[model samples]
Target: MTTAPKVALVTGATQGLGLALVEGLARRLAPDDTVYLTGRDAGRVAEAVRAVPGGGARVRGELLDVADPEAAALLAGRLEERHGGVDIVFNNAVMRVGPDDDPREIIDGYAEVNNFGTTRVLRAFGPLLRDGGRLIVVASSLGTLHHLAPVLHDRFDGLASLDEVDEQTAAWRDAVKDGTARSGAWPGFVNIPSKIAQVAAVRALAERRRERDAARGVLLAAVCPGMLNTPTSALWWDVGDAATPAQGAVPLLDLALGPVDPDHYGQLVRHGKVVPWRP
Candidate 1:
């Protein structure tokens, strides 16, 4: 009997790192395999699927906003019914902070999609993950504990549950709004905490689902794709010579399809290796 084809899905894949992931998957997966790329905009999703390498014959696009639990659930049901289950899931959806954006606004609103949205996707599609499947979250090196003060390290390291991470995130956001964030030694950059929460969620989920994931041979991980010359990066810094999205997708693709190393699960990875959360 012929081996079954793998089914992979990517969120927020209309452009940037997410888009790069679809392109890379198109190249790596067998021609018979299917790759699903989703974004909130149907037109962009269609356009992105059309532009994939090899004319995107094996790729499909869907309208999915990670923040919309209903849409996520519907898509999960559809994938389960049509493909049996998904073999790889790349959670790449993120609402980036703009140069002039309000700090409090980034925390309150963006977190809905950036931090919590990821958790939404996980809960929705996690059960449908096939045996030996991989779930990868595209986080950032800026989210690492090394960027935060030593006083805050223990708190983040000790986060054992999703609720704990959420509570900590809420407190951080409140601090920023009240001008006590700096006094509390939180990083000045708003994106840092958001990314930190994103990464922490991965660890918390991995710990909570350790037995289930182990029995099903599922792998969960978060990764920093590195600085890339994308519109999101352009919002904060000069693009000059920064790695392109295609280049940045390398590490992400590795985590998505590389050999399973339990040690790397729940860790933030970059350049094909686990990045230490602290010095």
Candidate 2:
């Protein structure tokens, strides 16, 4: 008997780590399998499809802006009709805006792209994930644990469940609105809060799967591919030699097609192992 093809979705696949993911995902695909490469621009996404290894025949292009929930829902709808359901949903879209004078705008902007957008994509495509499927969130572990205020540290690290996560998002919004976000030690960059939020969100989602729907082994994880030396990242990362984009894609590719370790679900992976997660 022949096994059916799998449907994999990778957001922001026009360049950088997202582009690299499509290439790695392609290696794992059988001839009939489909990997959807999505980005904000139709032309870039279409061009990116062909840039994949193996001539990108099995790769399909879709356009999406991570913040647009309607676009995400529409894509998920089309995927369901085309393939019955999707096997993997890779939430890799990202944004790093400046620390403007009005920190609230900066915070809201980052949350919209990195935190809110990630959750929206997951919520839209999650139901479509077949049993034993994977939900991968591309995150940075740099400030996930140790970079928040003393009061906020505990909540960030011990985010017990998804309900608490919603509460946390609300609190963040309040902080941004009240003009106390920076004074609260929320960090100078949006990447800090954005990544922390990513980890918390995935952990909460995994907890839900464990509690309410254990029958379907849909694994969720936030993976930090380390600081990669991609064109966009190299300009700011003059501190040290970083992994090439291909090197960064290893953990994501492995987890996307793995033995399905439940422990890894909701966990943050780094350097190919699930570290202490302390920060």
Per-residue lDDT of 74-125 in model 1, one digit per residue for the tens?
A: 9999999998999999999988888787786566677778877887887878
Candidate 2, residue 104: how far the Cα is off, in Å? 4.5
Q: Model 1 scores what on Cα lDDT?
A: 0.84
Q: Which ten residues in a row have the lowest lDDT in candidate 2?
A: 96-105
Q: Give the true-structure RMSD of model 1.
A: 2.1
lDDT of 2 by residue, 1-279 (tens): 976689898998898888888888888778788999999998899899878878432888998887785878888898899999998888999875532445566666667778778878877887788887888889877646766666667666667665576577768767876868767677656577667878888877776676543567777788888888865665566625888777789878888888777667678887567845564
Clashing pairs in 1: none
* Predicted structure with the largest lDDT when compared to the true one: 1
Each candidate's root-mean-square deviation in Å?
2.1, 2.6
